[model samples]
Target: MKLRSLLFVPGDRPERFPKAVATGADALILDLEDSVVPERKPEARAAVRAWIEAPREDGPAVFVRVNPIDSDEVAADLEALAGLSLDGVVLPKAEGAESVAMLLDRLPGDYLVLPVASETPAAVFQLGTFAGVAGRLAGVTWGAEDLPASIGAATAREDDGSYTDPYRVVRALTLFGAHAAGVPAIETVFPDFRNLDALAAYAARGQRDGFTGMLAIHPTQVSVINDAFTPSEAEIAHAKAVIAAFDANPGAGALQLDGKMIDAPHLKSARRLLALVG
Candidate 1:
């Protein structure tokens, strides 16, 4: 699926499910963890299952963020979802490849896995190994709040409430690792819903750094994130032109295009863009 922006909806709030499905997000993540309180877990799970079981329209892809595999609720969550139609399971507090392996042992192989890179201190170091998680592992993402609390350090944020350098470094490293492993690097969410400018800048940065998509905490942020990641008309046109020029001169290693030297590498980049367009 071409998921440029995946929005999260609290599982307990079933009233928001239909609205979320209509938000134009590439995917809708029905969150059962962090968003739903302990007392409401059972109710949330029931609501999510009911929503998934019912027939629906051509809505966004649906993923369920179940509780951590290590938690007591893991088995129940798995049993509940195993009988339903879900695009994937967003595993929270994933420590290493073993955590994914354990889940694979329990869940069916057909289900995709999107692990939240690390929410605990031990997980920060193991982020590199996320690619090793086999069995339809879709992508890797991270959370700042849990990690900081695990280490007794404050989560990094600027005066404007944007993620600080430390968190940005983690996000970049996760993206690099995902690329190294040849998976889409799904970016973490920007919590500041009110700061549209900051959110746009963050999404743009993710696109520039090779991230395929980002998770959204609010529907309002979906359009900006999707726009930042998609190739622009000018970019698409330039890519087509480069390919056309190369096709017309197949033997040439380099050629002039708009006053600039277009070499093999430039042509290769252009071809990738054209591929995206097609």
Candidate 2:
């Protein structure tokens, strides 16, 4: 799937589901975790189940963000999703391969899993181990929200809303870890949805830094995320030119393209860019 954007809709708000789907996000996550209060978890689960089971021919693929594996409500979350057609599950606060494997074991059928690889202090260290479970994973992502509270820190981000040094390290680890696992590195959400310019910059930076997609907290951010990740027509044309240079050169190790020397690595990058459109 082309997952340039994955928008989150609170599972309790079924009314918002169609609206979220209409946002043109590549996928929609019916969130049953942090978005739902503890008292309404059961109700949220039922709502998500009904939405997933309903008939819908067109829209983005649907995924659900279940509570943490250790939470008392997780089992019920999984049970409620049984026999439903879901594209995946966004496993928040995921630690390592073991936790992911446990969740996979409980799920009834083949389901893509996108683990939020960094949340707790320990999870920061376990990012590298995700390669072991890459086959079942759709991708890997990270978030800065819960970590500060977990460690009793004042905040995870600076006054500018950018991540602090530690959180930056966490983001880097998640990015590199997903690449090491051979999965797309999905960047975390930008909490300040009101700042569209900043959000666009952040999404552009993610694409430049090798993130294949980004999580969205609000539906309004979806278009910006999608546009940032998607290759423009000019980019596609340039990529085709690069590939054509290599093709024409036959066995040549390097070639000149518009006065610049192009090599094997450049060809690889061009091919990857073109693949995004496909």
Candidate 3:
């Protein structure tokens, strides 16, 4: 599935579920963890279940963000997911391959797993280990909020709202790890959904840095996120031209394209873009 924009909806708020799906998000993550209060857990799970089982035509792929693996509520969340036709679950506070495996062991079908890889301090070191379970991962993402609280940091970002140096390293690790696992590198939420200008720049930065998609916190940010990740007409044209150039000159190591040096890596990147869009 194309994941250029994945929006999160509070699981307890069933009223917003259809609205979220109608927002043109590539996927919907029905959140049952941070979004739901303890008292509303049962209500949220039932709502998520009903929505997934409801009759529907075409809509976004649905993913449920279950509570932390070690939490008491996780079992109930798993039970709610049983027999449901859904895309996957977003495992939060995910530590390593073991956590992913534990979730998989319970899920009966071939459900894809998208783990929020870096939440706790210990999760940072285990990011590389996710390659062990790459076959089932939809993508790997990281969280900046819980990490800061875990380490007692004032903030995960700087005065300019950019991630601090530590979080930058964490983000880089998650990006590289996702690539190593042969899955899309999904950027985390931008948070300031109303700041279209800043959100556009943020999503652009992620796309430029090789992230295939980004998480969206609000419906309004979906289009901006999708636009950022999608290749422009000129980009598609350039990619096609590069493919043609390489195909035209078989075995040629280097080629001239628009008076610039284009070689093996360029050809690989061009193929990647076309493969993604195609």
Candidate 4:
């Protein structure tokens, strides 16, 4: 899936399913977890399955956020989704590869998985295990909201709206872990839907910091995230130039590009940037 922006829609709100698709996000996550109340989960699950079974042409890639793997509610969530056609499952509070495998076992098909890798405290230390389940992954992501609540923190962020030192570490770990697993590093959502300017800056920072994509809580955030992640004309031209230079000088360790020495790492980054567009 081209996961530049994955927008979340409450599974209970079936009416908004098409609305989310119309936003032109790369993927739509029909949330069965936090978004739906306990009493309405069954109804929401049924609603999500109904939408998936209908087969809308040219719709965005669809994913369902099942209950956390450790929750008893997950059984019903997976049972309700048996044999459904969807892009992936968003596994919350994932501690390691075993969590991914557990979800995979109940699931009927080889669906892509986007694991929220740093929710529980123990999960922080378990990010490295994702490589074992890399083949089953769409990407790896982290959640700030649940993590703070899990640990009884006042907030995951400081007064400035930036993540505090600990959450910052968690975010960095998740980013590297995703790359270690050879998947896209997806940044968590910026919940302030009303602040377009801040959202633009935040998304741009994510792209600059090596996150290939980001999560979107609201539809309006989609275009901003897309634009932030999209390679600019200058970026595309430079990437193409790097590739051309590398092609012209096969096996060269260092090449001069725009008066700067470029090496293997630079070539790798250029290729990755181009891969995002193609």
Local accuracy of candidate 2 as per-residue lDDT tens digits, 162-225: 8899998999999999999989999999999999999999999999999999999998899999
In candidate 1, list every pair of residues with a backbone clash: none
Poorest 10 consecutive residues by lDDT, candidate 4: 53-62
Model 1 ranges off by over 4 Å: 251-253
lDDT of each: 0.84, 0.92, 0.93, 0.94
Q: Show model 4 residue runs off by greater than 4 Å.
A: none
TM-scores across all candidates?
0.92, 0.98, 0.99, 0.98
User: Per TM-score, what order, best first?
Assistant: 3, 4, 2, 1
Clashing pairs in 4: none
Q: Candidate 3 lDDT (Cα, whole model)?
A: 0.93
lDDT of 4 at 93: 91
Residues 160-188 of candidate 1 have per-residue lDDT tens digits of 77668877777777777676666778888
Q: Give the per-residue lDDT digits (tens) of candidate 3, residues 1-278.
A: 88899999999999999899889999999999998999999999999999899899888989999998889999999999998999989999999888999999987788999999999998999898888999989999989999999989999998888999999999999999999988999999987778999999999999999999999999999999999999999999999999999999999999999999999999999998987797
Error of 2 at 267 (Å): 1.1
Candidate 2 segments exceeding 4 Å error = none
What's the number of clashes in each of the models?
0, 0, 0, 0
